[model samples]
Target: MSEGNKNTNTEPWGGFDDNLIQRGGSAVIDMENMDDTSGSSFEDVGEMHQRMKDEEEVTAEAAATEEEGGEDGEFLGMKGIKGQLGRQVADEVWRAGKRQASKAFNLYANIDILRPYFDVEPIQVRNRLIESLIPVRMINFPQKVAGELYGPMMLVFTLVAILLHGMKTSGTVIREGTLMGTAIGTCFGYWLGVSSFIYFLAYLCNAQITMLQMLSLLGYGLFSHCVVLFVTYSVHFHSLFYLLWLVFGGLSTLRMVAVLISRTVGQTPRLILCGTLAALHMLFLLYLHFAYHKIVEGILDTLEGPNVPPIQRVARDLPNAITVLNATGKALAAGADAILTQ
Candidate 1:
């Protein structure tokens, strides 16, 4: 029984050992087959590595492109920003220059021109004057009038007055003849003086003046009595001189009004011309008191003897002088209206 049991145990243990050897041999064969397989060779591993390297390089190139594109976009945005800023700066500069030019131009280059025509308070006067010269551009009337005519016309008028005085004072003519000649010469000198002033004013203002306008301006002296008498005494016109004065005044006023209207209507050139003429007219009126005194004194000294009756000569001369001066003032006033319109 013992031998039989030992044989059975030996048999069972030998079978178990054989099974273990077969399983181990199968695992070794499977491992060797997996190692030498054609489907997973070193060349396949190398191809996989090459693909990963290629993918890495593509990723780096894409990153670089993205970085370059970001830079390009930033550059474009900066350029656009700079261009917009430049335009804004240029516009501001241009506007500043225009404003400066405007501020430099003022009416008559004097504050006294409107004093005779307007009776507004001092504060109002300055305000009105500033209003009249609004937009104060260098091209406005005051600058043109002052620049072109002020000095030259003064010099010319002075020369003419001296000549006229000399012509009558040389004692070559009789007293009556000298008086008449001096009167006529004085009238001519004054007319020439006014004409030159107007012409210079027109030239600077770019006005299209006709010969008729010049004649009308010269003939305006005929109505001087009415203006002075009417304004000074606050009297109404009733006489023939007064009627004549009214007609001339109307004509001059209408002409100036038309100029102002044109300017307001966007006729810029016409407005500038009218403004310049008006400014010069204002300046001329300023000189009238002094110039008239000097010229009249010179004429009287030349015509009437030094011992002649002062009252009689003055009485005779003053009325005519008043007549001319009144007309001149009216004309200047008309010119001012035109400038205001511009």
Candidate 2:
């Protein structure tokens, strides 16, 4: 091999070594240049990391906001359901109350059929009461008027209540329920029996009257009895009580006669009917008076007994106490006069 050839081969290897050194040197110089810009590059990386964290926080807040909105919606939905239930209950209660009120009203008045009777004006009631008190037939009285049981029912109840109150005040030893029942039954029985009897008689005579009308007439006639009872119980005078009884009884008899005569055709029949009715009415009046007198006498006997009530005893002794005080005062005055004369 020539010397040049050997040199060439060696130079090829050396060039390869030089190429590696140049590559290493260039790598070192690039590293030095990278160090000069290291601070700026780090700052850029920190900015990117901060931006990523900010995005993550935003995402979490949005998710939390969505969850709160969903909870609020659920709460509103429950409130709406509760409000609907409350309204439904209120409607049911209002409807039930209306139904109960309707039933009670129907039971009492029967307003559909008895509207006219129930609709009586206040002035009409006053006039009717006044007319019932008078003995004569009223000129403007409604003839063949439809009968109403409400007025008679109220009057009977009122009379019974008054009697019960009076009995209680007199300290009667009767059971309240038994006395009330007996009184109501007796009153109704007597009224119905007498009215039925009169109705049968009128029907036989072919009178143009109804049982209801007859009952209404007789029922109104009981007003005198109520008045007599009140006056007799309130006034302590026996004579006044008897006088009023006679007057009211006579007036009631005359009124019945006047009304009954108009219903009959023949003179003799009318007179007979009136006489019978008057006799029956007078007997009833006598029975009432005797019963009332018996009650009063019984109460008086109770008051006069050894076990007199405290209220009665106080009333009875008040006048005696006053007389004693007056006597004491007079004796004191006489003593003072004697002292002055000395």
Candidate 3:
């Protein structure tokens, strides 16, 4: 018999043939180069399978290590996506910071409101504060610029409220904490109420607006009201002035959401949102004005005896029935009399 035929007949089906294995596989593997620990006994098919599994695991780990270093990745004709994605994120942040700083100082000059501006630069903060007073910046940059401006800007308006409050209680003897607390509370509470309503509407529309942003812009709205108050301190603000600023504040808030979700929110939903926010703003302002007397009186009554009158409370509560007619009449007269006597 021929050698090949003799071997084929003599060898059993399960017997090892390194030549058969080498020929059947798609790739060549040098078994001689395999480590000594991997059993060299190829006679047993089960032992050969275990050795082959160990080699596969070792090769896979080595490939993975090289892939992490980007060598194997390139060898497979693929670029490192992780590095590219990281660079994209870093570039976006850098550009956003620059854009925020630029727009903060030059709002009218720039018309874009696509970017959400946060992380205001120190030098840009003062400029941003001034820009926020203008309707465009207040509405457009509520998230990035106006949000940070809330703190110091509200502090200024709160002080104005405090001063007007002191003017109201010229003759009254009350706890300083009570007076300060009322002014601070009224100032902050007003923002809280207004922002809460706006936040609810924005969330309903699936907008990306946040409570902090809403509060900050509401604080800016407070600045407008406080300016009106400061200008009319002697006579108190007219209802028309209140109405105008109310319209102003509401439109600004609605515009802010419009800018944020211009593509997502529909016109019908936008109108509904506007109507809801307008109602909220009107009610919030009405509550502040009409309820001021009762609120102050209650605080005074809470702090003192029930006998304490609202006029004898802080100046913030001097408005009788929330009307501008008799509102601040006593406080204004007191100021005039004190000036005339001096």
Q: Who wins the TM-score comparison? A: 2
Off by over 4 Å in 1: 1-183, 196-206, 221-226, 229-272, 279-342
lDDT of 2 by residue, 63-141 (tens): 4544555544222233223323433454466568769998998778766775654566667655655555565664244
Q: How would you encode candidate 1's per-residue C-alpha lDDT over 247-304 as one tens digit per residue?
A: 5444443344343333232466556655555444443333432343433443444334
Clashing residue pairs in candidate 1, if any? 102-136, 102-137, 224-323, 224-324, 224-327, 225-323
Strongest candidate by lDDT: 2
Model 2 TM-score, 2 decimals: 0.50
**Which order, best to worst by lDDT?**
2, 3, 1
Comparing 2 and 3 on TM-score, the stronger one: 2
- Ranking of candidates on TM-score, top first: 2, 3, 1
Please give each candidate's TM-score.
0.23, 0.50, 0.40
Instruction: Give stretches of model 3 more than 4 Å off.
Output: 1-130, 136-146, 149-177, 236-264, 282-342
Q: Quote the positional error of residue 43 for candidate 1 in Å.
A: 99
C-alpha local distance difference test of each model: 0.40, 0.55, 0.47
